[model samples]
Target: MRLRLLLCVLCWLGTTPALAAENSRVLTTIKPLQQIAAAVMKDIDTPALLMEPGASPHSYALRPSDRRALAEAERIYWIGPELELFLQDLLERQDSAVDLLHLPQMAVRKQQQAHNFQKDEHASHAHGHEHDHGSLDAHIWLSPDNAKVVARYMAEDLASVYPQHVDQLQANLAVFERSLTALDDRLQVRLSPLRDKPYFVFHDGYGYFEDHYGVKPQGIFSLSHEVQPGARHVNQLRQQLQAAGPSCVFTEPQFTPRLVNSLTQGLPVTVGVLDPLGSAIDVGPKGYEHMLEDMSGALADCLEAL
Candidate 1:
């Protein structure tokens, strides 16, 4: 009887760490997804980011470390094939991974094609699963409403994996929703004044944000960050800029091509930087909010009257 009791105690001790490890291994594909996951898993487990800052998801290849991270993770959250193309095959092998874009609750927007730029000549050579780029804009996190849906979905998945922390996850989701609501109200007021102001973005990625906030973008220079606009397209953009006299032209930190300088060489438009991936922002519970606030500030700074 004594021997049997001792073996039971030893087995219980050995299983504790394994159980803890199972519950704590949450991973996200990008920083923004990490930010949302971190917010939902606050005080539970800090979700790890797969793609480091400054890396473009459109063309990123998976490192060995990323493969290991995916294997070890008990729960994985990502924007799906349209965004993180590198993860498609690895995720197919893992049935547990959650594709946030496929969630019925998520309000997905269609990808906006570049107004005058030609179709990608290398579209066939593009890596990852064949994504319908025209069908959906996988940058769903840009919209606060979509972020809320993602947070709720994350909370549900986290609760299932770590049942002991369900209460905390639900609580975190509530707080995130409230914070998002407050931020939306603030941004609406701040960005409303710039509704009529015209601007140009380097790429069509900002459609969701622009549509959500009613900000005006005269046009986009490229359909995808990986693709460059042709010389004729650039000349057309120059002519449009000359005629419309846009308040600003926004370029992303990930791609500050020389073309932007060429477009505004003698124009009155102010240049501003926008970071859609939250690449520079530190990942935490409030990272998503900070990203939206920063974007709003960038827009207002350039769009407001001098």
Candidate 2:
């Protein structure tokens, strides 16, 4: 079931949001989302990025300056409370913000990754992410299909708000669709071989990508990023890793704690980097594709070496 947005971002293209269209500044919560909004608002005005690249939404804290960004922008977009816990209260105090997670067309992933290795086990201890039970996974922007839905939503809403820029926004959406199609095809072929390759992640934030590309990890080190796994649990994970032999362990760029290095030490595993937020990629019309391509490349490069 789709949870309602506190301010009903569901009606972003409605009359209320369209009240002020002239020079309305748009803001997006993260880099991936900023990239998509940029694509739709291409050449009109670039949407400001709220969370910088390489920052984990799970741990981000909203600042007074960020509040100024929120107040200044006419439209703000973000994944809902499940992911960006810090932004929930702030959004409740305002109406200009829209929760992309609440979009009706969104393809929400209720549970974590659908991995065969985790069916019988309680990976809840050391899984990728431990969202509240039955809560939606807020990484909705990772899937290309979902990306299309977002791009269209942005176009439709922006067109309604700024009727003068309708043609340009529609054209931009057309180009974005074409580019996403090509990216999706290439990813299908690129990640095809590595789907069955056993792997693990420091965070289970990659469910959308994994499910979309058919790449499932063996298991994860910890489910809650905020909690430290006990020595007993760590040893059990190490034993499981030793049994698997030469697989890869992917770590996110934002949080590469010393615990990760200690967990994989002396094991027959290659520790690789996977930046979910695409910290190094430039935010632009093609930024989303570059980010995903880099992620796929990182996975393929690390897994193939083993």
Candidate 3:
């Protein structure tokens, strides 16, 4: 009986590393997606992020290391051809690539055009970057409802890859849903008072959050981050701010153009920073909640100050 027990223990130790190796093959395109993937994979395995914290998905050029990571990844999650145009061609060829935007469960919103905002026809000459605004906004992760959908799909996808961890993944998904529900309840209470507060975002990317929380923005300075706001657009935003009265103008961490200061100058507007990518927040199971909380705080701080 002692010899039989010793043989069984040795066999179990031999296969443990193989199981761990299988579980660590997941990859996500951005920090927000990584946050959801990490939550679904809590304690089982951590997914790798394709884009670095400060990198702009609007105009990212894939590095050689990124290519290698893509080649080695067992499964890749991205928003699709709209947001990450750079990866569209390459991902199209990869069978393991999964476009989250294309998922039927995801609730998508159309990108809103800037009001009285004309396209910067000479933007390419000045900025040297092209902008392609897809009909749908790819920043769906901003909405907590969308995050729940993403987490469910991630759990399902990971379960298929590592069936041995299916039970754990399902438990993680349950925890995520519960936590999201609690967070949403708390946020609704906190943001309820600020619903009528009018503000302006530098980019039109926060429509999902604004719509979900009933936070209204007077207007957007630019539709695309890659394209700098032209003189005409800046003047138009200034006019809106003047007409709308004292309001806040929020800029993103990734692209706080110098024009923001110029546009808000001599006006009763305060500048606030909103980071959609959660660049400053640590990446982990609770990162997504932290990101949303930070955004809400940023909005409340500036809008309430007025």
Candidate 4:
């Protein structure tokens, strides 16, 4: 009886959460990052999403629970100073024990590479708002290549913390790569039917998607929401619409589309709303896949209608 009891205790100890929970606590700043972490942590528990769905990372205020989570987190992932400026101070204040990964920093060096190319191209880009010196577009995960980089980093982070599960983590990453590849293939097939269709966006936020998919924007209403276009610029955009032959004018959900309506007055131009922030979608537990799918479907719909 004593021997049996001892063996039962050992088995229970082996299966307890204290033994398995070390690698389970992951915290990510945004929904997209959380999705990448989810892909990498397939068999593991879902990560705590710091910024909830429909919340803007730019203006997210931390709650008391969020503060505690950040302080106690074993691993945290974020895009860095470009997008989540608010989290900079909190992140900086953390002690040395915490493991944190900055996705934009680890993934791409676009700030250095794209500057020279864009300098001459955007020489007169003075709408009002100042650009960051390094000016890294924190929106790296928007690109499939960058998403792969993030997945790699996530795998590394998981492996580092839980070397015992390294094989499992790598296998999960392989599955993630396969899934992302399949998603890209599906997007390519859907987009093949509308490659030549041109559109205008309220902002130049679609550069990553456009570059990846070879889609072109005929005109941009603005670079950032901070600045409104001048009267001359608006009129020029209006004239471009008139001459471009019924291109889709994409507006943001948060922004008013009245300007677009006035610009293409009496014309049959298609005006569609594109939410780069995944604003319109639910983006809850299973909503991440739906969000990306909807974006692609929305673009396809707009292009087909054109």
| Predicted structure with the largest TM-score when compared to the true one | 3
Q: Which is the leading candidate under lDDT?
A: 3
Q: After TM-score superposition, what is the CA distance of residue 75 in candidate 2 from its true location, in Å?
A: 0.7
Model 1 lDDT on a 0 to 1 scale? 0.78
Better candidate number, 1 or 4, judged by lDDT: 1
**Which structure is stronger by TM-score: 3 or 4?**
3
TM-score of each: 0.85, 0.83, 0.85, 0.73
State the weakest 10-residue window (summed lDDT) of model 2.
Answer: 15-24
Put down candidate 2 lDDT per residue, 166-264, tens digits, no spaces. 999999999999988998898899789877788988646787888999998888555334455566666777888899999998877644467676678
Candidate 4, 156-256: lDDT as tens digits: 87776677889878888888777777888898888876878988765445667767777767666543343444556556666767787867887766554
Q: Order of all candidates by TM-score, from best down to worst?
A: 3, 1, 2, 4
Model with the higher TM-score, candidate 1 or 3: 3
**Relative to the true structure, how large is the alpha-carbon lDDT of every model?**
0.78, 0.77, 0.81, 0.65
Expressed as tens digits, the lDDT of each residue in 34-127 for candidate 3 is 8899889999988888877888776788766677778778999999987898998999999999999989988998876554455465233211
**In terms of TM-score, how similar is model 4 to the real structure?**
0.73
* Candidate 2 ranges with C-alpha deviation above 4 Å: 1-24, 113-130, 223-228
lDDT of 1 by residue, 1-306 (tens): 999999999999865534433444887888888899888988888887777788778778876556767788888888888887777888977977989898999887787655454434422222222345577888899999999999998888887788999999999999999999999999999899878888887666777788899986877655334445466655766787888764688887755456567668888788899988888887889999999899889988888863
> What's the lDDT for candidate 2?
0.77
Query: What lDDT is reached at residue 232 by model 2?
Result: 67
Candidate 2 TM-score to native: 0.83
List of clashing residue pairs for candidate 2: 127-223, 128-204
